[model samples]
Target: MCAVEDHPHGTEEWWDRLGAVLFGPWAPQAQPGSGHVHCEPDWSWTLVLSDYDLWCVLGGIGRARLNGQDFTVTSGCVLMLRPGDEIEVRHDPANPLTVGYQHYTHGAEHRSATVADTCPPHFLPPRHVRLDDLSEVRRHLDGLARLRRRPGPDTRARVTAALAVLLLEIHAQAARGTGALPPLMDRRIHDVVEWLARHPTLRLGLHDAAASADLSADQFSRLFRRETGQSLREYQVAVRIRRACELLAESRMTVRQVAAALGYSDHHLFTRQFKDRTGTPPGAWRRSV
Candidate 1:
């Protein structure tokens, strides 16, 4: 019917309440659903959901009716269905849908209905978004699957943390109110950002990045700053530092090695830059993590 039904999770208050619980002591438990599904042509889905469900399309096309509202489903699309909502899904037989899904909820047992409305707007996140890079999100989904299969309190904790991170990532990618970049510009900038994020070690100068985007240096710089709120060099530095932090925390690499891997020829220079951005040396940050 393409009409959105009234549901608690569809409102800002519901998100606010959930946000409070998420950041509070009694955080929601993350339960991984069926990993990736290669749907058969005859397959269909319908449910009156009892928990928060996240569905990410991996491939193929489909149509979903959430609480009677229709949505076109395609690769990279993500849908968030909440308690008390109804969903029906079907796909084309020529190219059946493939999807990854997970569930999140409060308490040991799943709720039978929606919570009462009495919350804030601060926790409102996008209910749907088509990510520019799905692989990164896919990694988190797969990690959740792996963690859920393991038997340990530690793994369960990690699953919850991973779910939180995935939500935050979606929030960051979602467009907020007013003054978004034009679609073409947004896509171009997205490509640049994805490239920089994927190759933090590569030294891509401002002019080169501009050329890659088929724009003059000044034009590209202005557009990039307008779209991302950061200059090209600043963004690149931030990307490199973020990767450095990950390596320092998760890998056996020494600080010098990390610096070198990120294209910092001088280890001292990397340390100085890292300290300027993080207020501590890489080693200290690693230890704290």
Candidate 2:
């Protein structure tokens, strides 16, 4: 057996660090010039990026050359490029490209750190992943674009959370092709997660969730744990707690109101759960934030 310490930028320590930071309290700040761009018919440019760049093709056809590899960029196509990657981009004259792009940086931009370092962890999205259905991905991109135009009190937190989700979706899409699990099963697990996130307040039972995934309850339980490392019930609780945090931080809602909104009949239970997960009661958490 051999120990390989020199991991690449998107592997080993890089992935671990990215996962921690994105899931933790830190938010990646989009540089001043980050946003969507509509490329003209004759538009073409080449540049070496200095930080992380997320590029999504909202519409139209384009050609991109990244590190000497050419890509035909179409709608639903996503690309995550890192520092010093030379990229050349252009679009068709008849249909101009509407591109949603963001330039941001997480701390683990280099490959120097060893796997044992306690840097913030992040999930590294593939360099390219073409989604079969762009509806959901486009929704997030549109939300991001709109958020930029209408900044609000919770804009930073919302942006960070949304980007985290966007990356997860991209990683799931990439996983469809490369993961050891069957693609359909892997996709079903992610779909269930998305459905749960969308309906955070719903008190769905295990059977209902299994039905949504088109699997038996026992099967869904096993696979969900295998894929996500958490039981179905635990994930649901996490969803509620995450939403509770948002409500407490962003709105004038009292802790009781927040608990009620999340389908908690007894506010005390909510407080206990919040404390168990966050090391503080809801009120204290709200006050700290």
Candidate 3:
């Protein structure tokens, strides 16, 4: 389940309060586990992590330094930092900030459960979403907490599904409210382009390219154009044409042979694509060059 707390980490008193809230009345938690204290040049802060928890910064404008990268957190942004990850939360002292966080942690049995090696690492893409009421999120967290408190054969499965749903919701919200393309888009698209360049003659599909980039087909298409200024189809055709030109210039292969080598089923179709791109058919273009 999700638990939320509104506490500032600007003072020692606040840190003590936060420690009590995160570690429970039974034990005093420390950094790299339930809570941490960081003193930066301009500000000081505290970070709290629940066991296998999902956290949401309900209200505040701050930056989270995770894995040496900064993520901006404002109202309505939810962050799920996996166990053992480091997060620092600093507030603007001039404004005397108020920050809210929703926490979720798994039970003892599920706490040791590792996401399948096959499961893809979760990525928090950049987005701009206005903060709305978070009652629904709170409810989900409550349900999650209840499920965690109970241990059974079905407990682990239920918790996993709940976490999946929470992650999907976060992704959907970020996608819907965004001013910038996620950094993941650029990295993923670059991988796709590189893969195509390395294997131009291999038969590739839209799905294949998307998978290589670790994105859904539609997401990859939109972000690919936004990042590279070219549609995936356009990019694929350009790669094929470039490869075909290299073959035409470097090899003594016939047009049909080149087309087949480039995964084109019809020689005429390949010629049409080449002519459209170069303003000349394959043979004429080769002769002219």
Candidate 4:
């Protein structure tokens, strides 16, 4: 239930603020300079750079010639250039392009390469992935901008960690090809989950509930984890433990009766699992409550 924060992308100052928060000294500069170049491409121009850079295409679609091959560049397309690599931007004569450039140096240089190489080749589909949706990327760019505005050690470490996670997520998404969820297999899993919630006294198992989903045991296990972020067994155990705590607090049921009520034939096993999860034995927990 966490809401996403919106940060506008316009002007060097806005980019600069983002850089300060995300990257240290690798944020893009608004003005063209020795390490920076701003060109309004008329038709096409080849770019030869000394340092590795990440280009964010703010407007217009074009193509680039990297190394010895050609690649298309469009809005939301991020082009990463290695040092000494040659690239060409072919823009429409009528509509030129305005690109945002940021060069990373030393540690940032290696970090940028490592991140790009880790991402899957088809992470973003041909025309669907928008660069603006990448908040972590924006964060890294912003962190770099901040470092340029004011340098510090703490900021650098923060930028490194953020960049690493961003790269990992991008790589994972690319490997996955698409970011869409599979269609639900009806509400069998939901029914099973609700059953566990309502009848905390029942000892649940894969076979016990597999028929409800009409799923094979293995399939059910995998789907449960994917949907609930926890294994089915884990979720069941959690529910039982919670009910145990409630019974211990509200009822005068002895530990043995509580264990039997929760479908645990062996009181000792129940006590062990309870202690392992709650850091105290059921008897101790009951007394404390």
- Using Cα atoms with residue i matched to residue i, what is each candidate's TM-score against the true structure? 0.58, 0.52, 0.37, 0.40
Give the worst 10-residue stretch by lDDT in candidate 4: 1-10
Stretches off by above 4 angstroms in model 1 are 1-20, 107-133, 174-207, 211-222, 225-289
Candidate 2 Cα deviation (angstroms), residue 155? 1.7
Worst-scoring 10-residue span by lDDT in model 3: 1-10
Q: Model 2 misses residue 91 by how many Å?
A: 2.0
TM-score of decoy 1: 0.58
RMSD of each: 7.9, 10.6, 16.8, 13.5
TM-score-superior candidate, 1 or 3: 1
The Cα error of candidate 2 at residue 132, in Å, is 2.6
Q: After superposing candidate 2, which stretches have Cα over 4 Å from the reference?
A: 1-19, 25-27, 108-122, 180-289
Give the worst 10-residue stretch by lDDT in candidate 1.
1-10
lDDT of 4 by residue, 195-261 (tens): 8999888777787778678889988888888778888888888899999999999999999999999
Give the range of the ten consecutive residues with the poorest summed lDDT in model 2: 1-10
TM-score of 4: 0.40
- Candidate 2 global lDDT: 0.74
Which residue pairs in candidate 3 collide? 1-141, 1-144, 1-145, 2-141, 53-104
The top-ranked prediction according to TM-score is 1
lDDT per prediction? Answer: 0.74, 0.74, 0.57, 0.59
Better of 1 and 4 by lDDT: 1
The positional error of residue 180 in candidate 3, measured at the CA in angstroms, is 20
